[model samples]
Target: MIGFSILNTINTDNDDLSGLNEIPFTVSYVTSIHRAQGLEYKNVKLVITDDDKTNMTHDIFYTAITRAKENLEIFWNAETQKFVIDNFEEQTQKWNKEIALINAIKNNK
Candidate 1:
């Protein structure tokens, strides 16, 4: 009954679960945002799913917004036309930084 964490944000083709199977303790691959609820990690990595302003009111978005106990990291794909990253702990991390950065770069003259 021990807890170890490795937050993976690479949305690659490899079976991300492969490495988890070797660990002695439980290896829970909460791939979908729905499955990630009620979980927290010292190192949190959120893989940005294909969601955005057009389809923002999503359960996956809700689930992804609330799974962090400490540090949180995110991954957004290049193909995405619109993606919004939400941090439930807004008071702590100040969620607007990434969006600001993106907008600034996109609008640079």
Candidate 2:
């Protein structure tokens, strides 16, 4: 009922974020993006919730975007779409400008 069946390969075998040891393998495998930092795997799929750019902090977006090794997917509703487009146009200009400056510096060097 989704886009691709290949996505099933990335299905996590274990999903436990709370690392409370007393809980025994209570912490299994799949972790939310926050806890998944500094880890690596073949594929990553993120189901983005209704909360969008208008509410969440920029760091949240940054963290979510950076958590992929090879494949990264995000599923969101209409609210998420509008929030992303609106916030992207507003904030990404500065990010683009900074990237351009960095490229210019590297080129000069």
- The number of the candidate with the highest lDDT is 2
- lDDT scores of the candidates, listed in order: 0.57, 0.64
lDDT, candidate 1, at 66 = 66
lDDT of 1 by residue, 35-109 (tens): 667776565666655654334444555566567667677676755424343333342254378777789999995
Q: Which candidate is the best by TM-score?
A: 2
Clashing pairs in 1: none
Q: What is the lDDT of residue 22 in candidate 2?
A: 29
Worst 10 residues of 1 by lDDT: 83-92
Q: Which whole-number lDDT from 0 to 100 does residue 39 have in model 1?
A: 72
Note each model's CA RMSD in angstroms: 16.0, 14.7
**Alpha carbon lDDT of residue 42, candidate 1?**
61
- Please identify model 1 stretches exceeding 4 Å from their true place: 1-30, 49-57, 78-109
**Model 2, range 1-109, lDDT digits (tens) per residue?**
2232122233466564343232223222467766876676556666666653465446666676677778877788877877776776767788899999999999998
Model 2: residue 27 alpha-carbon error in angstroms: 14
